[model samples]
Target: MVTSFLLAAAAALLNAQEPRPVEQDGHVRPNIILINTDDMGAADWSGGGSRFIQTPHLDQMAAEGVVLTDFYASANVCTPSRAALLTGRYAVRSGLARGVIYPHSDYGLPQSEITLPSILREAGYATQIVGKWHLGTVPDAHPLEHGFDEFFGVPYSNDMSPFPLISQREVIEEEADQTQLTARYTEAAIDFIARQAGREQPFFIYLAHTFPHIPLYASDAFLGQSQAGRYGDTILEIDWSLGQLRQTLADHGVAHSTLIIFTSDNGPWFEGEAGVRGRKGDTHDGAYRVPFVAHLEGLTPPGAVSRAMAMQIDLMPTLARLAGAAMPDDRPIDGRDITALLQGGQESPHEVLVFFDNDQIAAIRTQRWRLVLRTFYRNWLVPLEQFGAVHLFDLETHGDELFNVAEDYPDVVESLSARLETLRSELEGLPQRETPLNLPGDE
Candidate 1:
């Protein structure tokens, strides 16, 4: 009787450790791949209205998956947007809202915060990051310490100085070849996926591409092949990398069991078309709005288009749910689970979306209206001046944001302004850190 009871207990423990299968559709653990591009605009892809550049693979992915039309980045810049994406919280909450982190800077995403990979890793998934990190370069703040099992990429943006190629904390190359970065990163991702091909344990790959940012570079094969010049060439290379990843997944027989997401970190900086006013640094719709596409063989409907409003912050909660991972209950998560919107075209979970320019409240957007609280040109190239103190826009009628409807909708303005103030007060109550000093030419 004693031996029998001990055997029964062992079996129960093993069963509890096993992840649910896909057919059950309850807490199924599928391989997740998040592909993030740097400084890509909403209109950079052919499906998103790029006439000069051809992004056939990306267009094909959109046609065969779900396309999010009104998706937004958490912030108009890199460090803050990335922070919000990884933590499921506003960048301001982590005190990383002032500007992008420079190589010489001594700070990064706080160690106390929980990251997406950390949660997924705890749930039995092998995690890897294969491109630009940009979060932090210090030893304590490296990607390896942030829950990623492996890190093979540059520490920051390619345009930054001393851009070396690193592999698990070791600088392999003093200066990595920019031209071969996309190809090399794709190879690394394919290898990682192939290793997990038939394994019972699921995997998560964050293939963050470092191209199309600035000072763009493409391999010899694609150097002069685009009508839009070097910028277009880099985009074409990125699209090719996507096709390669898809083929590798199919080859490994894991295509049916994987979830793939493709999006940009922020808006275009100088070259790409944002399809709206302003570029990367401004608080306009163009800077925050970006292209978002998701593909899951058995889940997302083919060619489905969702105009539901969502942000980069939503990825944490949504992915955590899909991965059967528990979120950190000790802190607030600003992102909402967008699973319904992704699978069934349901209404957005968020009633109002807030846009931040660094730590300050810049604007707020509802389903049909947008209220701009403060407006100033933050782009370094553009002259600094106050465009206005407060303005309201009817996005449904005037999507261009040219007309101010504040007088027509006084009540709406009053409500949104109050909401902004409430948020400001809440942030002020949190413990603050000294804002990072912006370095010259760092955006």
Candidate 2:
């Protein structure tokens, strides 16, 4: 049974703004499609400065839409970032801040939390997820239970064992063919859009791709087709998938009414290039910062570039506003609506963005400053003792985070540190599940 609090919240949100009627003016609610790539670096695409990987489709999106230069993933890794992205709350709030969800884990995203799909569904949109879902593996944590009407993809990362292709609730394939994952996901997404061609209901497709992560695979047509080898080939295939989606939307005459957002879950793992210092699992900009491009044929201006600071958590509130859904007032939502920034506004919706390394508060960034609260192992061969616990960097002058400005600006450190402590206390105070769900006879 659905909780009363959720029912009440949905009612309030639905009442906040009536769903716009489908009209010929093209001002109807836009179909929202989020294309999330796995373990893709900030500079993996051609538009982001990759010389080897040919991402003509992605470059076209950047050329014709708004490119967010300072966008970030909520966390440096997978599960937590995904949690924050869907919930509009920090991963810590979901009790998924510690690490990635493993196959053996029995717990998943809490049902008590409201996801973007849940809110959008209340606002009369068809919600579907067509890619990797790392949040949880159990039935209670499945995407269908979380309000997505359709679920057609893998349950977790492709690198995880016993990876199977799932269609709704059934495991269609015991072991999925990794090489065809991107193509299959794109076909599914296109099919979903085609089915909604003439329907009044606008759709929300969370098309999360499974590739470009470790154990890379590419179809025969794209293999060895890049100077950057297998990694580049995988990205090219992703680019192809994007092209297919765009063409299909245009063919169905819904291209102009669709808002397409392309980004990565986090930074690169072992391959790909990041403009900044660290890679995945680190709190540095390289790990958290990912390529962000928003394309809406009539809404977003062409050739617009924004340096505004935004994070994955912002998608919930932003999309809610776009879909005529109001945010739930019962809980604290960390993400702010970045609609203005996407449409060519200069001001960032965020004053400060927090970075987490697992459950620990690793760093925090303002527009021109970043403060490191803690440091952790970053898969570096060097001794961990070489790093410090607290450090500050003037991002405007030194974007690489090479030099420490903590000694020069003691006041900035003190202020950010205080804010971090307050956030920590707030998160710690939230009610959480007492323990992970145990299977039938587990001790």
Candidate 3:
């Protein structure tokens, strides 16, 4: 009787209707393609105030999709930000709270953790990842073991030494040509889409590009293509990749059934302009804030600009709700369901977000106020007036966070302090685990 009851429950759960059809062919699941760029900032695109470079494809996507003005990555660096996006939790909570996982590191994202691909695959979606997979290099922590059927990309950043491009655990190229990386990845993505279109199951693709990060490279065709120099040229190549993916979707006749997301992992590297204060490694507005555009046919209205504050952690739960996949019941999920906000809801689902600089709590921000606990990672607050123990800024009036108004807004500071304490305690109380790190003598 118990076995029969469990089977019946599973059937009932599977019958639940998703937010929308996953595929245009009347399939219960919809296709998802998330394209994430590395070290790209909020104003990197042509329409977003790029001074010299042009990103016509990205701008076109923003014009067609719901453009989010206040989108933020969960962390400043790549690994943590990626961990938060995949697990729907802070990197600290996932035991990957600090610097990136190097190739020599003995550890990676824990296998026990529930990833976005794992959840969707359980819901009968064909999962694949094509591009940077910096999460881990070990066999146990690879994308194949994590739920993706195929993984084609580098294990870490391009600047890392001996940068070989791996295809499903095998090194296909000892040293990949950085200039043609974007083009190659785009071609692979188009091929994957074409192959999946013939399958009965819906698909999920996570395309993480590794360009415009550091030691930038642009294809010969894109060289000297922009007045912004090689950096601008590199960005233009990424724009071309976007145009290719969109064309592929339309060609497959799955444009209406596919949800396309375009965003960056963090702020600009060294050369790209960070519209706000601070650059990539800092916890300032520029490091966290990024351009986000989501296109969903029959759902997201064209030319809609949303000011709702969203984060990378929120994607897991939001996509899960859209796919009718049951969220993990065993662990804590930091991400909230933003399905309503994506569908034209005005209010932001998040009221507060903690700024983490490596393993330390750098600051916390509410709707309009921010409280700085430490200025080590970012010394921008030193020039500004300081309160007794913390620095405060009213962002509504001072977007740059230059002037300190802690003396006048004591109540706001107190409220934000309280919120910060609650979050700090919550983060500290979670079971701590030793994050994996590469050693000198390791393989």
Candidate 4:
């Protein structure tokens, strides 16, 4: 009798020890890869609803991973957006709000600001960046100084090159073999993984694509490979590049251990004959809304969708959470941890996110509404302070955004407007202090 009772108790304990037969939780921390495309658009990928563009690999990424439908870049341009991606703060706080940086721009992002890789590396991640680093041109602003263990691509924008510079330390006049650059970046990244796997360290890679942003150069193989012409071909190259990265990880048997994120800096910059309308500068949904997706090998929900409000500003904190890193205490950081939403948890990162133009804050967004303060002024001479009245739109249910959203959901407009007004008034009156961030940007 005693032996039978012991056996029954052991069996009960074993059953309890087995993981509960509930849905698997994909919240485990993993290695990371972030691929950021420059000036990519909303519907550029087939999975994203682009009928003309052929993006099979991208479609697979969305299909096999969680597609974040409402993600926004922190800024509509490069420097600000990149800063937000790294620091998890809006351009306003990162001191990168005005526009993109020049090739020889004197300043870059400040070292005082703790970057995304810096945060992860502190938590034992082997961090590297293999593409555009347009954050700044100053030596102190290079990726090495900003926390990456390795840097192997253009120090500034790709347009800053045709002839690639050898190192950030010196600007040489060597011509860039665009194909070789991409291949070398991939090769170098793979080597980093091999090195880390040997040393038993995890890795983080930020691969920024330079093609499709530009002077439109393509390799012989990828050029004109699609009906969408050179532009579609360029996107195809991006897709190919994604395949290479995925294969590299899988070959190493570490694919399931890595979490890859794919997104763009901003919306497409219309420069081709496609620019017949020339409204790229209109600063509407078309100007800023871009694709954002997060993937954790064997972890993320497949073909799942998260309609949460995410932004480039949210990535740093989100990744930190995945890697179990701490937010900086020396200064306030802005990126909210939306990992819960990514895991099919949260409704949104915040009640709303503010959009900006120059030093002036411009728009606000809630769950279902977007309010653009299209305050237009040719010059600063308008002591008028704020000339742009706010526009309320039901972004979740609108098209073209040409319709007066306030005319339909008067309640949404009022609720969103009241919150926007209060936040704006308080931010406008935020007290000034003699602090590091309070200092002026190169603009």
lDDT (tens digit, per residue) of candidate 2 on 81-151: 99999999999899888778877787899998899999989888899999999988888999999989999
lDDT of 1: 0.82
For model 4, give the 10-residue run with minimal summed lDDT. Answer: 271-280
Query: Per-candidate TM vs. native?
Result: 0.90, 0.89, 0.89, 0.83
Off by over 4 Å in 2: 1-27, 377-389, 428-443
Q: lDDT per residue, candidate 4, 1-443, as tens digits?
A: 22232234334435453221111132334678899988777667778876667888777877888888777777767777788788887766756776677754577888777899998888777888887888876778888898898887776667653446444355443666665565666677777776765445667899887766766766777877877777777888788888888887777766656778889887777731121111223345666677877666344567888877878888887777667678897776666877776665548868788776644556677777777766334433232225433566666567356555666666776787688778666444332111132224443
User: Candidate 2: lDDT over CA atoms?
Assistant: 0.83
Which residue segments of model 4 deviate by more than 4 Å?
1-28, 161-163, 166-175, 271-282, 375-389, 407-415, 425-443
Ranking by lDDT: 2, 1, 3, 4
* Model 3: CA > 4 A from native: 1-28, 271-274, 377-389, 429-443
Candidate 1: the clashing residue pairs are none
| Candidate lDDT (C-alpha), each | 0.82, 0.83, 0.79, 0.69
Clashing residue pairs for model 4: 88-335, 108-136, 375-388
In every candidate, how many clashes are there? 0, 0, 5, 3
**Candidate 1 lDDT, tens digit per residue, 31-54?**
899999998888888888888889
